[model samples]
Target: MAARRITQETFDAVVQENVDEFGLDPAEALAEAVEQFESQGVDLTNIVKAVQSGASEDAKDNQTHTVLQILESLRGHVGTANVDGMPADLKRFTEQCKLGFAQRYLAAQKDAYPTILACCRKVDGEKASLLAALDALSSLTDGQPDLLDAGGREFLMGILREHPDDPAVTVLAVRAVRHCCVKHEQNRQDLVKAGVLPLLTATVSRYSAQPELLCEACAALRVMTFDDDIRVPFGQAHDHAKMIVLENSGLKVLIEAAKAHPDNTSVLSELCGTLSRLAVRNEFCQDIVDLGGLTFMMSLLADSLDHQDLVKQVLSALRAMAGNDDVKDAIVSAGGAELIVMAMNRHIGNAHVCEHGCASLSVLALRKPNNCRVIADSGGLLVALQAMKAHPKALNVQKQACMVLRNLVSRTQELCPVILELGAEPLIRQALASHQDCGDLAQAALRDLGCEVELRELWTGKKGSLTQ
Candidate 1:
């Protein structure tokens, strides 16, 4: 009997059968089929060339399904063993095919921006296809900002505007914005300029029932509002972006998102982070408090004690919100001081938590004598002191801890001796000598501790004048 000859159709049938019948991954199934053919001494050179050539056409089509097919085909070949030792022509063909597919797909997306924008403007039956196309474009523009130009960003905003009620479409659109802004400040600025923040906040509010959408929307807001450049300098609010976020009711949306998805840690973490960024300004600090931000954050910390990421973000938000006297008092009224100290004890080795925790307490201690008393009474001072000693090399922790000590001692004379009793002087002096940035603050703290003469002498290396 003559054996049946293997052909391209035979391999395709085997792959399709494996995929359709056994539900195997196409790449794995293709790999298995290739191995079977090789076992039968069937050369795969012609098959590789055929697959590579097909990928070129698939890429040119520039449709989601075609691109996905090309990706799967490439994965299949790369997953198959011994492909590296194949003929140099096959190897080169595979490499060139992959490169060409990527270039062609990206080129198609770049050229299709206007078409995508028109699709985004459609509010009819093309929603699904539009969403699929947006998803594909998102993948194409993941790390390629050139593909996500101003027109592309406007199209994304259009999706959010036209389909505010469509969770799936909104999620894709927001995720595309997130991908655009992840590592690109210009994209972030552009998104902000395009008023994506309001759209994102609306997405969070409209899709409160969808945890996935809330997470993506919040994630985008987190990235868009991440501006270390515009900071609050010298007790003045300088972050206009944050002001815009406030104007659009961004905080209300985030709080609502948190309430809607209390169990979603990712959503909660992003919400807390975005709120922290917004609260950097004093004007927004009171707004966060008015919105019950302090109580919400304390509850999150209390409930999410096991989630270090969530707890750290909550602490950061608390630090930012605590800048206000009303918020500080509100935090104390809600047992926030104890919460801060408890987080410090819980995540001792977590430098971020400790640093933010101390920073929050320090903020609360500033100009609020009752807050200072509340912190010292809640054992917050001891916690900050221990945090300083434990993470001595952590400059941020030390700096924040010194600020807490300074605030507690400067305004609350009753707590000054308590800080010294906790042996905070050595830590302050060590921080003074170790970290240059923390020196002035640490010296001020030491002076408030009644070590002015000693600090001045140690700082200047001269004890000529004790009275200046």
Candidate 2:
């Protein structure tokens, strides 16, 4: 066949012809197949057939070579075709190809990564094969880390090193490095030392646009930082690892994902869960507030009333966000205090919601003198006081209410008087007296209100009754 036109069929036929007539080198045949697959879009099924046909006649010694050639061809197709169409029976074929070629390439090259790196680089800018290639690479790495040597390793890193901003590569590298770190502590440090934190952080900060990527990158970062060898490094990199998950991007994606898929309770719950962790960090708490995370988080709480667990998660996120003064103020400014009180009053029958809501209100009350008044003025102090008696059977609810009283009494002595005036002392003392099991929390509350001249006498009166 004269020069076959540069399409898929012609490319495959041309490669086959060369392999048949000239006994073309296996590598060259594979390279030709890759070009054809790229141009003609040959399915994996077809490649399997072609490889089998060629291998059927190979001598025992050359069977491995033929199989390796087939793998090389598939590897080159990494991100091109949706391998989903490939038959399951072909899995053996694919795996054999990966092991045979990758092992030989690694051995002969002795750390040479140019070829593999070139393949990965091809994946870099090609949208069609980016995910496909990454998926293949991930599978190839399942249990074999020795598949590439130092040169190959460095080359792969270089592909990432240069285009650190590309989301696809950045995401893939983050995943690969994390995988390597799981087995090798040194890999975690190497990635950190290689500046993966900034890359991960940047990806979070800018790529919130891609939720899957955002989730994956965050997950990888969480893993890396959890490892002792790299936790300190990751922490030192970003002001003590304080803002690990509370960045603009993460919050944005979570909020957007919740809004985009309201019916997906599991996904929304997961988002709220991530926010809860980030919200607890002082460094990130303010960032969450600054980004108006409070309002979106509160809305999630309201929208999830039917989902008790999700409501609790959203409430926990709210509590974490409001743990500090600035964040408390943000919540108050965003009308979160009012919204929280509404949720609390409406969901009092919900034990989980009641527990977290009361506990969170207590956290906000103790923030500082200035913020305590805002909390009390929002009817928070009274609602919590009532909730104590209404849900007295709820051990956690009672404990949280006591804690809120402790905070309020300590922060705003003036408010301490109002707490006492509203029969607060009676409710708190009742819980304190009746529940010896909660003595620690009760005593803390009693201690805070001790100096309140009016409330001191009340605790004293209840002290005798506490034993009864």
Candidate 3:
């Protein structure tokens, strides 16, 4: 296609009648028409005049779609690939294109969901699609959340990775990654490796008082740390994992986030959970202790209401901390058993939470059967029994509860007969009724009771009641 002179008549036709055909801005319509005209050996001067003459409120407004299309067209045009590649003339046009799209997108933010969606689809499906252009437009505006996607994410990350310390792009990339990387461990790790973690850490420490960014940073950190397969890069040579948290500054940031966002239950819960795992080292535990995290944990458990996940996380952390006799005593003194019993009863619908709650209970029951008795007295026995009534349907819960009951009996010895006398067998019957595992647990419990035959008969749906 030879560059031909675009006649003024054709250019003006495109600009004036854009709404009739393309429904786009006049400058953008004229630019695209001019590109086509130039490709066909048309004069460029007439095209420029048509574009400039047609730039009006309505033509500008209509040009938005055309502008987006131009950006899309520019994506593969090597001249605008990166900041370094941008020629001045092309850069000016790109900036103008971005401004046009931004203006239109903002005005129609609610209605522009479809346009952004289209941009994401193109970028993800095609390797060289205009993600950077769409992202730039997205960054300048708010309420265009659909722009956050794998393609949008990769594009932003690419920019940030290329320009490591550019705070503006880095900040946008971090913010974008936080909202988009929740479910993908590899993506999260990529962001971390791209120096995102350090950037986020700096933000947290610099704006130590910014609760929202701190919360997001903590969430990203929690996700990264929890990926069992991906290990944090150690800053020191002593031990990779140990160095990742201990010798380096990362752990301090986490501790500060926990202390910084005490009112943020979600942040505290995740922080405590991560800290509990990190507390395998005595030094880490001491750091946690020095930071007053243990007290925060107990208080979160006691005071934070209606947060089942937080409660469960705190309980798990407490369970980790329970190795310390003082911690165990503190838990018992803080009504840990009672709180757990409530969690158990309240989350009967969620098997995992119930399982963890019961695991925590089993931990406490093993410590002091009197606490188990407290649990038993608090309708906990009833809850566990009811849980078993469904049996193999929720085998994990039953297995955990069985463990708890076994722990209770072993510790108290006095509760075994009461457990049986209180009709726990009926639930065992329901449990075994589902599968062989239930039969095994029922058999083991009976063996523990020194009444295998009688218990076996009861488990098989016998008419005789333990109380009767």
Which candidate's TM-score is highest?
1
Better of 2 and 3 by lDDT: 2
Candidates' lDDT values, in order? 0.70, 0.60, 0.56
Could you tell which candidate, 1 or 2, scores higher by lDDT? 1
Quote the lDDT for 14 in model 1.
79
| Residue 122's lDDT in candidate 1 | 41
What residue pairs are clashing in model 1? Answer: none
TM-score of 3: 0.54
Q: Mark the regions of model 1 whose C-alpha exceeds 4 Å error after superposition.
A: 1-133, 139-147, 183-185, 228-246, 280-283, 452-468
Best by lDDT: 1
> Can you give the lDDT of residue 33 in candidate 1?
80
TM-scores, one per candidate: 0.67, 0.48, 0.54
Report clash pairs, candidate 2: 8-40, 78-133, 79-129, 79-133, 111-151, 113-152, 235-241
Off by over 4 Å in 2: 1-190, 205-209, 221-290, 295-314, 345-356, 367-401, 413-439, 449-468
